[model samples]
Target: MIGSPEHFHQLEKSLARKLGIAAFQSGLQVLRNDRGWRENEISIDYIWMVTIDHSYSGEGGIFAIKYKESKFREKVNPGELVQGIFTNKDEISQIYTETGTTDLRGIFDFNLFEGSQGITLDGVSYTIRISGQNIDTFISLSNPNTDSWKKWEAEIWALGNRMALASGNKEMINLFQ
Candidate 1:
């Protein structure tokens, strides 16, 4: 559904109230509260970052959530819509370019296709893991001539280390270093 300015505020209020109501009704506690979209801008269709108090235990705890509009509608049609999980991040990397294929090599094993588009997703495996709390990946590709993968792998690994820091996982920081 399209989000318009006039409807955003009401929507936000309704959502917050509902969330609050739901938490109370469900006997959940309120922990951290952050909203990606301001109450005034909820009309625009964009991703949202929300953190709340939750717990795997029946007690309670805190966690984060990132949600995007569902591409699935009344009828499920597979089109050019962005397909991904609700997550908190800058953006998900799309594998549309040969360059991306090359980069995936740093953390994946790719099977090259017999086509000109350089489609490398064919029978490939990506290796992204948290080793000692750091994100390390194993990658292999059918085409070994491209240089993009090696070039970006280190940077990505570094970013992964930073993410570990944000998560308060000290091991990740040391592992990448």
Candidate 2:
């Protein structure tokens, strides 16, 4: 999914088409719900920090979609809301504006991961759980019975941050609010 921005765009387009415009629109709004600030004038800068380490093995990155309002407050974790991102284990890393301990080192598979709440990705099923918004975001695939489950923790992690947008139009307004 890296090296080709066009590919990601195409994938996004395909997903939008498959999921439908209304669902996608709702999803985007839901995605924006995680942010603390929102408005009709400001814009949001959603930056995805793509990285990796020894433990986790994926091309996933942290997303920092800024706010688009005059209000400057802390962001919250959206468990089931949010357009393009989710958190099953809200405890894995601090999100929005908390302690700023945004260093994640494990679990790189799905968008959301928690305790016992399983979601399938690339044929592998994972358990996702989140303590709450701006709380514990965790994902566990630990099951001695299966090989896939054993190496789940050190493969995926989802973290997010926020900033602020200064300008945009009506159509672009819906982007990173």
Candidate 3:
């Protein structure tokens, strides 16, 4: 899809709305410059963290999303797409790069092909992913009517519903609302 950043952002927001996620902002990048870390730009293809309402759990709850392009070094197919779920931002950040900051530390790791796609919190195992190899893949801001776009939307809705049910997070279930 060919579109401006703002248009892409709106598409993401629309997906969030479909999943009943109401409290979300555009994903942003923070880079260190001469003045320290500063906001850079919104992430186009990736949706960042989703905050669970406090009422859903005693402690704060959060989940993050990441889109990984297939890698040749690992023998991953170019057509394969991976979407990861993380318990915290730091975990996701590690896949991209270490932020060199101590503020985020709820750490865990996952490998798609190795079956390492889950985390244990309070002694409960939560499956943290839904992936496919070239399942009509891609969400383009400029091509909303493409087969890839429809497939992505369906998968997102299903995954969101499943996550919300498993986590007992009202916020996730009601995100779009």
Clashes of 1: 8
Rank list by TM-score: 3, 1, 2
Q: Which residues of candidate 3, in runs, are more than 4 Å off?
A: 1-143
Q: Relative to the true structure, how large is the alpha-carbon lDDT of every model? A: 0.26, 0.28, 0.31
Cα deviation in Å at residue 92, candidate 3? 14
**Residue-by-residue lDDT tens digits, candidate 1, 65-100:** 122223322522221111111111122111110101
Prediction RMSDs, each to the true structure: 18.5, 16.7, 16.3
Model 2 gets an lDDT of 0.28
Cα lDDT tens digits, model 3, 46-162, are 334322222222111233434233433334323221232222221221111111222111232222223223432322112222112322122222112334433543444455455
- Model 1: runs farther than 4 Å from truth? 1-67, 71-146
lDDT digits (tens) for residues 1-177 of candidate 2 = 232434334433333333222111111332222364442222232212222211232221232222233322454433221223221121112112222333232333433333344543432223333322233333333332333444443333313223212222221122223
What is the overall TM-score of model 2 with all chains considered together? 0.22
Q: What is the lDDT of residue 149 in candidate 1?
A: 51
